[model samples]
Structure formats: structure tokens, C-alpha cells
Target: MRQKMLLAFAAGAMLASCGESENAEGPEVADLLFSGGTVYTVDGDATVAEAIAVRGDKILYVGSAEGAKAYVGPNTLTEDISGKIVFPGFTDSHAHLPDGGDTILGLGLGGLTSAEQIVHAVKAYADAHPELPAIMGSGWELNLFPDANPNKALLDEIVPDRPVMLVAADGHNGWVNTRALDLAGVTSETADPVNGRIERDAEGNPTGTLRESAQGLVSHIFPKPAVEDVVRNLEAGLAYQAGNGITATIDAAIMHDHNEAAYLEVSSRQDLPQRVRLSLLAAEEMVTSMVTPDNVEAVVEKLVERRAQFRAQAKDRLDADAVKIFVDGVPENHTAAMLEPYVNAPLGPDHRGEINLSEEALNAYAIALENAGFQIHIHAIGDRAVRVSLNALEGAIETNGERPRRHHLSHLEIVQPEDIQRFAPLGVTANLQALWHFNDAYISELTEPFLQEKLHRWIYPAKSFVNAGARVVWGSDWPVSTSDPFDSMEVAVLRKNPDDANDQSWIPEERLSVDDMIKALTINGAYLMGQEDIRGSLEVGKQADFILVDADPYKVLPEDISDIRVLRTYIGGRQVFSAAE
Candidate 1:
């Protein structure tokens, strides 16, 4: 009887410490408490907890169910999860939300395998909306066309009278009908730009296919969407991100010339659901014009004033981290600058892979930007362009040393192992899109013949970089790819085309664990943007940004990882997404 009394006294003391009262009247109090679920907190130690507590946009406690219950107050909202899984809200390091929104708003031809199907979809959309002036569409694959490349003649055959401009899946090219060409004033005499190709036939006639810079010819003439339409599209994009449990996204390339004002206008309102980071780009000539020798001090003062005003509103959301410079186009259309001649089709005696900037000019630009303390994200695809970019980066580091600010390599599709090492030392973050591994079969076909075993190892080389001590971050390259972090994570972990059965995944050894992958999508990205203390993972006193899934990725088979559904997304203690009404 004495031993039993002692045990009862200890138990009572424990209950008291947990703040439990046997005679309590109301429902268990907690600002937000969830139990009967697995919480995979991607903390530094990767600890697992049974429950979490939130209070006014911050996580107050994360421990046992009993511990979380202690924070319950009179008006607490308690949720019994009954064995679900939760994780930190996903963050997309790179995206094009507005562009993705625009594409989703327009005709979606992503899955169509043939021209006939595209025609049917286009005709159906036109019939449904008779008031549309021109039927514009995007996401057509070059392989789907008869010539292995698209042409306006085919679109002309489908809808001869109506003008159409359909962008290729890669976004590096487009196909416009005769009417669109006529409207854009693109005639037989129009010459291709220095870095872009205007596809031509044996007779030297325009073939309606615009490659690289030439696509601008038709794009400049396309009608702009109304403000209302823009708002709808932006909302659609945010909804898509929220639905996928993404809390933040970085717009990889922001064409401020066309849409910065609209972004400011839309963002001024309260409709933005996801946090946005926009990278600004200015033409080389325009950048030079801003810093002329005659009025350098005045220009610097003006830029500082403008930056201050932008900072006052943005605080952390908007950043002018870098000025984008296009060194060369993609390797798909034979425009990317390469060290060696392509095996399939060698260039003539005078021809080489297209180099947009001469070495002298590029070096000068790099020095100037480095001196001005601007991080540069150069578009490099071919080996030669990559070399040029590396040289420029080396110049920057030699002049300004390395710092926390990360220089980016956009579409770094073909990095040599040595170049990755160079990046680590220079503090250049490898902002890679793993989904590109599943897509871009055309690239595989071209690279396989020459690169052999090295063909598909470039996209998201997680294991290699981690071993090398490089800070690698995951990005969706949205609009170019889906913004869904789950989908992106699935692709990274599995390294296979979820849709293709016959296609093989490259370098199975390159796969990373779920924990590492989540860190890349969360903490690493947060650290890159310098928001580690405020966002990233769930911890006491941190912002309450998290997502609850129907299943636990840690316990599930890797193949089923992609299918795990998102039940709800919470940001700042508010329910941003919930399955239940």
C-alpha cells in the first residue's frame, strides 16, 4: 500500500507539471494543437515529435502531446490528426509564377502528342470564346511536329485565317502562322538577330519557326492581357502554389521591362498568398547608359535612392540581387556556345557556337558588375559558354573576393565536374531544377552520342555536390517546370520520369535521402535568401509555416512518395489551405 501511494504521488506531480486539471470544463486549450500524428520536423537534428503548438503566427512549442496541451488556453483550436504527417512548408527557390499563371490562363497543350490534337484543342477554345481576337497558345513540343521542329505553315493549314503564335515547350522557340508573321511585320527580308535563329528552308525562305532571339519578332507584336486578366492569372498561380503547400517562391527571371509595374500594382493589394523574390534584369546597353562617364555620381545617387524606396516597401520580399546577362541560348537549337563542334552536324569553316558577347566586352562587363557589388546570373548552356561564365566569375572573385551573396548559373545544364568545384569555392549556389532530368529528352538524344555515360548526370547532382561541400539548393524553374515542391522532390529522390516507363533514370547513385532533399527545398533555400532565422523549418519562436500531408514520406516507399497528398498548409498560424470545408 505504501509503494502504490508513492507511485500515485509521482504520477500526480507529472500531471500537474503538464498543466492538466481533472476537473477542467472546456475543450483542451491550445492556440493550435495537433496530436495522433507524426511530425517530421526538419530540424538540425531531424527530430520526430508527436504534437506541435502554435500561438499567433509562431510555433510556441513542439514536443509530446501532453507538453503541447500545456499551452492550451480558453479559445485554443485543437485538432486531433489521427495519425497523419506534417512537415515544414515547402519553398521553391526559383519560379516564374506570373508566366506560369499566364500559361495556365491560356490554352494548355502540354500533353498533346500530335498537331491534330493541338488543332482540336485550339478550335474548341476559339469556339467557346468567340470574342478572342487571336488564339494564342504555348507548350508545344518540337518532337510532336512532322519536321521534328514546328513551322507556321502547319498552323496556317489548321486555322488559315486566324493568327496564332504557339510557344515551344522549351520557351526558346516559337511557331507563328502566316497571319501572325504578317501582323509582326516579319517578312522574307527580316534577318535573324546575332544570337537567335530564324529557321529557313533550302530556298532561303522564312519557315515560320523562330528560334532564340528571333521569337522576339512575333512576341513584340502580341497583344497584352488586360489588368483584370493579369490579376486572375496571378491569383491562379498563387492558388496553384498554395494548393501544393509552397509558402515561398523565387522568380528566376523577372522581365521588369514588361511586368514590374504590374507586379508592384498586384502586390500592393492583399491578394498575394505566397512570398515572392524577384530578380531584375537590364539590357547591357541600358546598364551602361545608367552609369555614363559624364554623370556617374548622379546615376549612383539615383540608383541608391531608388533602391532605398524599393527596400522600404519590400523589406525582404523584393531584391535586386543580380542583373541577368544572356551569354548564349540553349544547346537544343545549335545556338549555345560549345568548346567542340557538335558531332551530328558540324559547323562550317567560319561558324562556331553563338557567342553573344566578345571576350573583351564580357570581361569588362563582369569587372564593372563585380565592382558595383551586383551578383550576376548568366544564362549558359554549352561548354564554351560555361567556360566564359566561369572566367567572368573568376574575375569577380579575384577583384571582390567571395562573400555570402550567391552568384547563379541559370540553366546550368552541362556543368563539368571541375566547374562545380569552382562554384563551391566562389560561393555560387547551384540553383538546379531536378525535373529537367525527366523532361528534355531531346537533349539526352543529342548528348548521348558524344557525352556517353556523362549524358544525364548534370541535372541535380545532389550526392556529388553534397560530398564536395557545395551549397546546393533545389528550384522548380516553374512555368519551365511545375512549381510543386512535392513533385520536384519526388523526381529528385526517384530520379525517374514519373510518366515514362521505357525511359531510364541516370546515375541512380546520385539520389539523396528525403531528409536532405527537404532541407534543400527548405532551410538551404531560406539560408540562400537570408531568411533562415524567420522561416525554413518548424521550431519554437519561428514563423508557423508548415504543411500536413496525408502520409509520412519517412515511412512510405520511395516510389509512392510522389503520390502523397497535401491535406493542409498553414502560414503564420493561419489556415492557408485545408481539405475540409
Candidate 2:
């Protein structure tokens, strides 16, 4: 679904086989037929077929090209896709959609390669929008700067008169100019808020970098993106997901953050491009204050009722059944709840970071929510947060007894070895962003030095989780990173940047096979979305959600995986994207 035309397949073998099948016996006439190429079903046994027939939105046939001919009729739309590599339409388990959409509409910084370009871009954007009180945008990398720290001075060089606020590509940190910081009244004297930091210099002067929750200090001053703009942007975001071959996703933080309005707007038009799962944000206070043993059932009852009510209005495309909870912050800011003190504890020597909720509160909410039938999508980045979440899941099982649930923990950034095995037995999914598994310049400059050797080594154990029998799934966490599925697939298999051949595999031992990575992106992610049965694989009865790639990933070089192009994307047998178009 990515945007790019690739007539890369051999001109001879490429499309020679997309003709009607010779077998003419079956009564089931296919509405559409694709023949003479490899079709990776990603089914239970991982069936690979030479042809596929679609009748309406469901797959009508998948078998040898000759066998598929039986399902073809006079009116069937057939394609000779012999040269293409077919795959299931992808699913992004964790993405901030409306926000991802909004970033694209902002200063448009994602494609810029240098800091100088960013400074000029900001200045140009500021000059053009003088009526705006402040400028805000995202998509800047951290490794481009010294110590992964971006000072406000760069923006000051261009727009010293206006306030400029921009976030890092990861969305975990923020950089602002002095005018913006001053408008927020954030100075050396301003104390770091809970679960955040205001990076300072040797003299304790604000360095213009805000980590985690500290971004909020400057956020309040910027004009909110109008509701209409947000809706259009969100609609654009869903199309972007489709462009990346993503047909489904859990918009990680939706309704609770006021994204529901935009989602409802899209649904009302019946223009939703993908199957979206609305993971309503559960405020930290919801667990810390609202849920207790005395009122746990009552709070859960109300939450379930609200979810049912929202679902009734959201239409079939957007489902509201999951709750997103943040257990801790990211490792880059030292706000991630670690089991032990950091190697360089700038906050304090004894500080080991803290969780957003108490153990008792998390336990109560998880149990009640599970019993009430809500999918819990937990953001557990630090080791302690991972452990705390596992404990909560364990308590949920002990209380309600193990049952079917798509409950998952996203961003298992650091999972202790002892707790790694707990996911599978607990039926918990390891919702991973493998794109961040590499040991990059940012890690060397900012994160590695701050983590204990053992903890640092435990980063992104995708293989360990897979080996531990845990249900492994992949998520883009877009706006934080690129949503290109192949990029993450390459990282999961190589554990390094696919573009840099010289880069060492960060942890070669933990690398997964290509097949495992594919399953994680396809079936596993669908499992997390609670649509595996109907949407994940290309089974006969399943919805025809699949993609066609220009080259076979299995036949390509390990590092060249990301370069493979998605030629087309289909959902429910309906073509959603075509690179050639």
C-alpha cells in the first residue's frame, strides 16, 4: 500500500500467469481472480498458493492456478499477477491516528534530512503564518544532535521573535525556542513535573528540551488544531495507513483524548479506510483514584456501559472495546520505570523512576476490567512497568480464571528474563515496536549510558518473547516512527537499520526468521485486534485483506527487505491502493 510504482518484476515471468484457470467445473463463480503468481495465505499451516479467487469481500478459492479456474465465471474480474508477491493486508497494533494525521498537516518536517533544513522550514512556516500565536509540529530525529539533545537555540536562529515548538520523531521529547519556553514561563526555576523533565545546562538554565509530560507545559499556549481540521487530517491519516498496506489498527489513544469526534465524523460518512479499534485512553487518575476494591465493580460497570454506548454510535468500521493505560514513560527521558537506579541518575542518585499507578490500583483495575470484558492495551516500556503489568495480568487470571482476551502490552522496551515467559501462559500479547530495536547513535549518546548493563542488554527481546511462547505482534507506533511494515520486519529479522549495510546486528541471537516476522505483522497483529478469524490470513472463508509486493521477500537479500515495494493493497476484496495508479 506504500506509494511508489515498481515495474520491477521480470517482464516475461512477471505477469504471464494472471489468466483464467483451465478447470471449469465448480458452481462457485469468483467475482475476482488472481492467478499465475505466489499467494502467501499466512494460514495456520502457512499455505502458499499459485492463485486466489475472491467472491464479494470473502476469499472464494486459494489453490493451484489450475484449481482456481473452476471458480472463474464470465463476469469475474481477473488479473495476471504472476510476477507479484502477495501478502495479507497489514495491521498496526498501536498507532496514534488523529495525531499521526495532524503531524502531516503541520510544519511537514518528516522528510527533512538536516537540522539546517528544519530551522529554515520552521522560519518559513512562521513567516507565512504570522497570525498564529505559536508554531507547533513534529517529526525530527534526536541522533542528529549532540547527546541526542536539541537545544532551542537552533530555532532561535531563525525565528527569535515567535514561539516555535517541535517534537522529536519518537514523540517522547520536545524542543522549543526561548520565546515559546518563556510564554510557558518555563525557566531554570521551573520544577520538572511528574513523569517528565526539563533538561538543563551546568548552570541549571533551561536547555529548551522537554522530556515526556514536560511537553504539556508549552502545549497549552499553542492554538488547538480546529475540530474540522482534525477530522480531515484523521481521514488523511487513515488513507496514509492504507498506503502502507495497513487495513486495520488499534488507534492506541482515541476517544478519551477527544479523538472520538473525528472518528465519529469519518464513520458517519462511511469513509473509514481501515478497520479501526478505538483504544480509549484511561486517565491515570482513573486507576489511581476512581478504582478501588470498594467501588471496583461499579467503576468497571460504568466503563463497560460507556464502551457499549460508544460502539453503538461509532458504526461498524470503528470499534470501541479496548482501554489504553500508560504504565510509565520512555527510556530516552529516564522516566521509564526501571527496576534499579539508572547508571547516571540526573534526576537524583537514588531515583529509579516511578510508575503512574500503585500496584494495588493497577491490580484492582486489571481484574475488574478483564472480568468486565475490556481489552487492556498497556504501555509498559521500562522493566518495572513490564513486571508490574505482568503481575496485574496474573492477578486478573487468578480472580476471573484464564479466558479469551486480546489484552496486550505495547512497547515491551525492556522485559526482564524472569517475567518474559509469563506472557504466553497468561494469554497476553507482546505488542512490539521492533523498529526501535537497533543500537543506534541515540542509544549510544542518550540511553545506553543511563541504563545498567544488564537492563540495557535486555532491550526489545522479540525472539525471547517468541521463544517463551508469548503471542508476538508488531505495531508501527506511527508519529513516533515510520509506519512502513517492511522497515520493522527488516529490523525484527536483522536487528539493525536495513539502509546501513555496515551496521552490526544489535543482538543477532535475538533475531527472528523472516516467516516469524511476517506472521507477527499479519496474523499476530490481527489477533491483537480481535479480527484474526476473519481478517488475518487468506483462508477460503476469511475476508480478502491482502497485498501484492513487487518482489518476494523470501527471495530477496536480508538487508534489502525494506526496499521491496507494495504494488497494491486490498481489503475485503476491494482494491484500496494501487501503486501504478
Candidate 3:
């Protein structure tokens, strides 16, 4: 009779009980229950809960610790997370996961300070890997070199026999040896591609440096990684992100067809540690040649077919609902399009940088993508690039009407005040790389002179965007920057590099609050990925994706936030990463 009563109560409450008879029915007993921690829901109210119960992959309960006890039963695993802070699993809105993984597995050149160091490292790597067909690596910063430009002469002196190409930290430029240039048939007569530049000497000879689209000349000839290698690298990258409390990420640029196939294979095997959304590269020609009205339709058709193919292949875990377009290059290289002339242009004062796509082409492409039900993710770093992207989005809206999907504008380094106000009204997301908010070597030494008086004011405007009611999401742009969300959060909040004692806030007014930063990393990111309703916060019906940290970021000093490490990360109620393990 007691068992019957208990079963009735459970059924009435819609709670599942473990070890119940086959005849018994209820909602199955929670497989796991986490209690005694400060649970940050990050919901609309930013509510705090004391306990949460999970059944299968969904949260079954979230309320008082005592109330959670009712759902506990045999076969249930309960953890007492006393003194720990629990948060919704972080989501990286922008990242190159596969490429970052490849960097880790290959020659990691992320932090070398000089050209000499790069040469030594490259030589050591080359000597160790004589079997490689072509040498390729990334992560060289322009500020470390004299004149902020790396020439072929340095590379030729070290590895003149073989082709070698090293990418800049930002991935916007490529530095190669003379052999690489020669192998790609890039010569002084090679007319500058539509949106790319081949740096040349005074005598019109190729200098072995390529910017933007021109990098494709050498990159296309480079041997592609095997499918197994790509899968291995992607797994490594996903593990790194999970260890840092990231539960989801978007591969900002899915470049090759092989990359898409690898991603589909991984998702099929359920080996992916975190949720992944892929943004297929739509403007490949713009990167190598140019986007013209003549080829715009062909490009759109290709993107549409690719999207359908990927979606049909991996219908469950894969999301190919977005397309990536590189509107302009980086500011440090003076390639990012701008409204006003650059203060220190290599060509002349009249040079305001170059736009990768014409206005008509951009408009047509954006409209076509939107009409096909794809979210547009544009890379716009400069003020003029941002404005042009906005104009394209506006045209798309005028053509197709407003859609449910919120488009994104990433790497917002130089948004004008007028453009800042346009974000909310246009329903566009400000996908910001908050890690670059501080005065880093790139900003101080390489880019400052070019901006002149607009230095601080033109940087990331996080606070201003939020105040204007724009939806803001944060990303690391990993491989270009650190993938740790806490590191980015600290920089976002303090507006200064946490590692540099001498550094001051670059733009004090742009600093975000702890609450705002948390939301940006969690809920806002989920919204950007179109998964807000499923896993953004700790709700009764949402997916059980959350993490346990060593300390509460809200209670710690702003500067100490980055020191608060993630002890465990959970995705779909499964412990995928643990610091103890």
C-alpha cells in the first residue's frame, strides 16, 4: 500500500522513479542530481537556484535543495557541489575549431616574439618532418617584425630549398619563402587579384608576402589533411574547449568540402564533445579573386546546394544554417575597408583600404542567402566594412522582409557611432571578439599609428552596444586568440590585459559588467546559434548543459575572474570533461 501511494504521488508529480516495476508509470527517476551549489540560471530574470535534477539529457527539476530530494531514488547519482558555482555551459559564438586543433597538433607558433624565433622553430619543425610534402604553419604576428611586415628574404635564408608558408596570427596575411611564391607561379606580372594584394619590391618583383585573397595562390596548392587527421584535430580542439567550460561552438569558417565531410562524420559517431554549428564559406572567390554581379548567382546556387547536402548528410547534430562572408581583411595590414583615408597608408594618404565585394554583389548575395533561410555571418573589421555589411543586410531585409534568424557581424573593431546605433534596429547581433579589447601588441605597436586620434574610441564598443539594446555575443576567434572564455571575460570586464601590469584600459567606457559578460558568453551565444530555447539556461525542460567552477566569478575581483578555473563540464547531463580526470 505504501509503495502504491508513493507510485501515485510520483505519477501525479510527473517524476520518474528508478527501479520501479514495469507496470509503474511516472516521468523515469532523475539519472543525476546536483545540489548545494550556487546555480546561475542566466534566464531572463537571471534567477538563482539551489539544486537541479536531470533525467536522460533534459533537466527534470530546478528549485530548492529540499524539493530536489523528492526526485532522488535508487540508480540515481547525486553530487553535493558545496561551495562551487554552477553556470550554464559557455558557448563560443565564433571560432575555427578544426584549424586551431591543427595548430596544436602541428608546429604551434602562437607566442614567439621575433622573426628569428619563428625561423629557428620552422627549421626545427622542417628537419623533424622531412616526409611532409609542403611546410605549412600559422601564428606569426606582424608587430614582432621590423616595419611590421615579414619578407621572403628571411624565409629564403632558412628554408630556401622547399616551399614554406606561415600565416599571421590574425589569419589575414601569409608570409612565405621565395620557393613558395615561385611554386605558385606568383610573379611581378601576376596582376593583383580582385580583393587581394601581392606585396612587391620597388622593382615590381614579388616580395613573397601575400595579403587576403592572394594567400589562396599558395594555400590551394598545399596538400590537404586526411579525413582521419582532420577528425583527430577536431576532437582535440573540442576537448580543449570543453575543458575550458565551453559546451558549444561554431566553426566560423568551414572552408573545404573535406572539412564538411569530416564534421558530418564526427557528428554521426557522436564523438563530438560539444555541440557544433558550421558556417560554410560562401565567398571563396572573393578571397582569391573578386565578387562580381556576373558570378553572384552562380556563387549563391553553389552555397545553397552545399548547405542542402550537409544538412541531409547529418540531420541530427549538424547545423548548416549559416554562411560566412569575408567582407574585408584586418586593420593592422591596412586592408580593412574604411570610410576615411588611412593616416599611414603604404600606397598614399588617399588609400582607405579595399572592399572585397562590390555593393551590388554583396546585396544580391545577402538577399539570396536570407531567402534560402540561412543566417549571414559577415567578417567586418573596419568602420567602412561594417557600414557596407550593414548596408547589405539592410538591402536583404528590404528584399526578403525580416526573417526569424538573427544575422551576425563579427570582429567589430572599428564601428562608428552611427553604425553602433544601427545594430539593434536592424536586429543584427554584434558578434564581438572581446579578447581583443585590451591594448595588446597588435593594437599598440602595429595599428595605433594608422588610427591616429580614433585609436581608443574606435575599438570594441561593448557597453555602448548593450546600452542601445543590441544583442551582444562573445567569441575568441581561437587560433587567432586564446579560446578561454574566462580570459575573454576578464578583458571584457576590466578593459585591460590581465597579464600586463603596466597596461591600462584602452576604452574605459566600453567595459561590460560581470552579469552582462556572463550573459554574453551563455544565453546570448545560444541565441546566436538558434539553440536558446533548448540549452541556454537551467530551465525545467532545457538540456542539462552546465559547468562547475572553482569559484564564483561574481564574488571574485574583476582581475581574478580568469583565475577561476572550470572543475567540470557537462553536456546533455553527461560529464564530458573533469579537471580531476
**Top TM-score model:** 3
Q: Which tens-of-lDDT digit does each residue in 1-581 have in candidate 2?
A: 22222222221222112323233553478999888788877776666778888888888787778877778779998888867878888999989888788778767677677788888888888888988777888888877777667888888887888788898877778899999988889988899876577889999988889887788788778776667888878877888898898989888875444466667666644446788888766543211123445666766776676687666677666787887778887776677889998887667777777787678878998987887778998989889999999899888888898688778999988889989988988889999888888987657777788888977778888899889998888899997888998888778878886667678889788887777778888998888887888978887778888888887877676677788778888888888887873
Using lDDT as the yardstick, the better of models 2 and 3 is 3
Q: Assess each prediction's global lDDT (C-alpha) against the native.
A: 0.67, 0.79, 0.81
Q: Could you give me the TM-score of model 1 versus the true structure?
A: 0.86
Candidate 1 residue-wise lDDT, 384-432, digit = tens: 7777888878886787665546677766766667776777777777676
Model 2 local distance difference test score: 0.79
Candidate 3: where are CA atoms >4 Å away?
1-28, 285-290
- Candidate 3: pairs in clash: 16-28, 16-29, 213-287
What C-alpha lDDT does candidate 3 achieve relative to the native structure?
Answer: 0.81
List residue ranges in candidate 2 displaced over 4 A. Answer: 1-26, 111-113, 202-204, 269-271, 284-306
| Backbone clashes in model 1 | 2
What does candidate 3 score in Cα RMSD to the true structure?
7.6
What is model 2's C-alpha RMSD?
4.8
Q: TM-scores, in order shown?
A: 0.86, 0.90, 0.93
Candidate 3 lDDT at 342 equals 79
